[model samples]
Target: MNTIQDISKFSSQEKTFVTIGTFDGVHFGHQKIIEKLVSDAKNANKKSVLLTFFPHPRMVLQKDSNIELINTIEEKKSLLQKTGLDYLIIHPFSKEFSRMTALEFVRDLLVNQLNISKLIIGYDHHFGKNREGNIVQLTEYSHLYDFVVEEIPAQDIDDVSVSSTKIRRALLSGNLKTANNYLGYHFMLNGNVVNGKQLGGKIGYPTANIDVKEDYKLIPKTGVYVVKSNIDGLETFGMMNIGNRPTVDGNHQTIEVHFFDFNQDLYGKNLTIELLYFLRDEQKFDSISALIHQIKKDEKTARDYIKNNL
Candidate 1:
């Protein structure tokens, strides 16, 4: 997939089939929409273009909403890349861009700029100034613009029974299995490895500190989790701790990962850790030895799960 950062800078002579949304998690429901879009575009001999936005509409319109996204913008792009899309246009979303009326957005951007021959949108999709546009408006515009508008019906969407919001809630509540099932894949954290206080090293469980740069990216419920990562093309299983060092009277939450049977320098490498299972909630142990003992038990549990399920 060719990713274009700014939609304004994109100009194509070939006609295109398009879909527009935030596409936050790129979950199974979203995947079905993209699959249809790509398939339809190919059947019509037109290019498939997914017009998603950065900063998300909520982040721009609802500043006090305190919205935490399931996937960062980069993560969303990576997930969409597997769908065989022709183009992924990540337009900058702002108050000014949101002010474009429904007709203007359709005629100017979709009809003229994107050269959209067909447009696919999910049910209840809204656009334009104050989100006044709806499926009815889109159909009307399509007739005037001489294009086709397809709305994935309410029944179709409801059948999937999954949404980004629900998935976020599931993760926040420590329901990893339900969240992953809804997502049709493992929920992941994308971050760079950084140096830590070396507390894990002292406990005989050296860890790599993960620095997730996206502030809006959602972190799962604080606990110990079984995780896996592909490091330099090798699958590595590990246990991750997401909590403060309560035993040591530490105050801030940290994400530290310790891989099993693998030792290599990862101080500065970017990594994507996929959460496989939740072991237990983080708690304050009586002493460092107690903490270390619990960690050993967690490691055994993780290895057993990895052995049987993975």
Candidate 2:
């Protein structure tokens, strides 16, 4: 798919079938909308365009510094790329942009700028200037602009019992299975491997300490999880821990992964770990030896699960 950062750069003369949303996780519900967008565009001989906004509207409007997103911008783009969209337009979201009136958004942006022949939107979607625009306004604009507006009814769009919010809540509660099922894929954490205190090595379970750069990206609940990653083009299974090392008197949270039967210098390298299963909640063991013993058990459980299910 061709990704355009600036809407003005999209100079395509071909009329487009457009849909707009944050499409945060691109979960099953969002996938249904995308599928219809692509299929409808193809059937109608128009370019499929997905218009998404960056710095999420809430982040800008509410100054919500604590907002955590399920997917980073790059991750969202990567997920949407698999949906057979022709064009992905990522527009910057700002207070000024949000101030545009509903009619200005439809006439200036959608009709004049995008050359949108048809708009496919969710049933309850609202936009423009405090969200004054709704399906009813969109239908009115369609008549004035001589364009078509297809509303994916609430029942159609919500048939799947999945949403980004639900997935986020599930992950925050250590419900990896429910989150993954809703996402239709494993939840991934991408980061660069960094040096740790070498405490795991002393316990015979060396780990790669990961540093996630995106502060807005949500990290799952504190626990040990079964995860997988690619190292030197080989799929590697591992158990990951996300918590403070209470046994070692460590106070800060850390994300560390110990690959089973594999050892390599990964510091300074990037790793994308996909969470497969929730092994157990992180515990404050009585002693270092006890913690090590539990880790061994976690490793065996991860190995068995990977063997049978992977």
Candidate 3:
């Protein structure tokens, strides 16, 4: 998909079909909406476009206090691009922009700027200050602006509505199975390998330290997880520990990954850690030997899990 960061660059293309939202996780529900949008746009011989925000509007409007983001800007762009949409419009959300009224947002953005011939939105979507725009308001504006407005109804699986918030909660609580089911894929984090104190090496289990992106990202609660690490395009089963080394007397938390049967140095390289299952909570060990023994057990458990599942 063509990522349009600035509204001024949104040139007049074929008749546009658009949907506007944060699209944080791009979960299964979001995928369903995008699929329908693509289908409708194709039938109408129009370009399918997605309208989303960068840094998330809430981050700007709420000052420094913002909820944890499920996906980064680049991650969102990459995921949306996989949908085969014609355009992905990223609005640089700001306080001034958020002040616009609901009608102003639709009139100026959708109708005037994008020249939207058809608009699609989630069933319970809201926009503008105080989130005043509803399906009723959207329909009313469509009548006045001479455009089509469509709302995709809520999607449910096993009676549970799929949502980004729900998936985030599940992931934070270390329910990887449920979170993956909701996300339609394993939740993943990609980061550059960085040098760290050689504590793991001292203990005879070397690890690669991954530095996660700070903005638009939140680490799950400190724990151990069974993960698939993609290094140089090869996937390896691994066990990851994310937490402060409480037992080892370390002060800062870390994301350290040890790939099973991998011996090459990955320092300075990028690694994508795909979380597959949660093994256990982070805990303080009684001694270094105890920790080493537990790590061995975790490795065996991770290997078995991957062999049976992956």
Assess candidate 1 and give its lDDT. Answer: 0.91
Strongest candidate by TM-score = 3
Candidate 3 at residue 60, lDDT?
Answer: 79
Pairs with steric clashes in candidate 3: none
lDDT per residue (tens digit) for residues 89-116 in model 1: 9999999998999889998999989998
Error of 1 at 281 (Å): 1.0
- What is the C-alpha lDDT profile of model 3 across 101-196, one tens digit per residue? 999998988888898999989979999878898989999999999999888988897899999889889888888888888878778887899998
> For each candidate, what TM-score against the reference?
0.96, 0.96, 0.97
**Displacement of the residue 252 alpha carbon in candidate 1, Å:** 0.7
Candidates 1 and 3 compared: the better one by lDDT is: 1
For model 2, the stretches where C-alpha displacement exceeds 4 angstroms are 154-160
Candidate 2 structure quality by residue, lDDT tens digits, 1-310: 9999978788777899999988888887788888999999999898999999998998898885688899999899999999999999999999999999999999988998899999998657889999999989999999999889988764323455566778899999999998888888899999999999988998899999999999889999999999999899999999999999878876899999999889789999999999999999989989888898999899899999999998
TM-score, model 1 to reference: 0.96
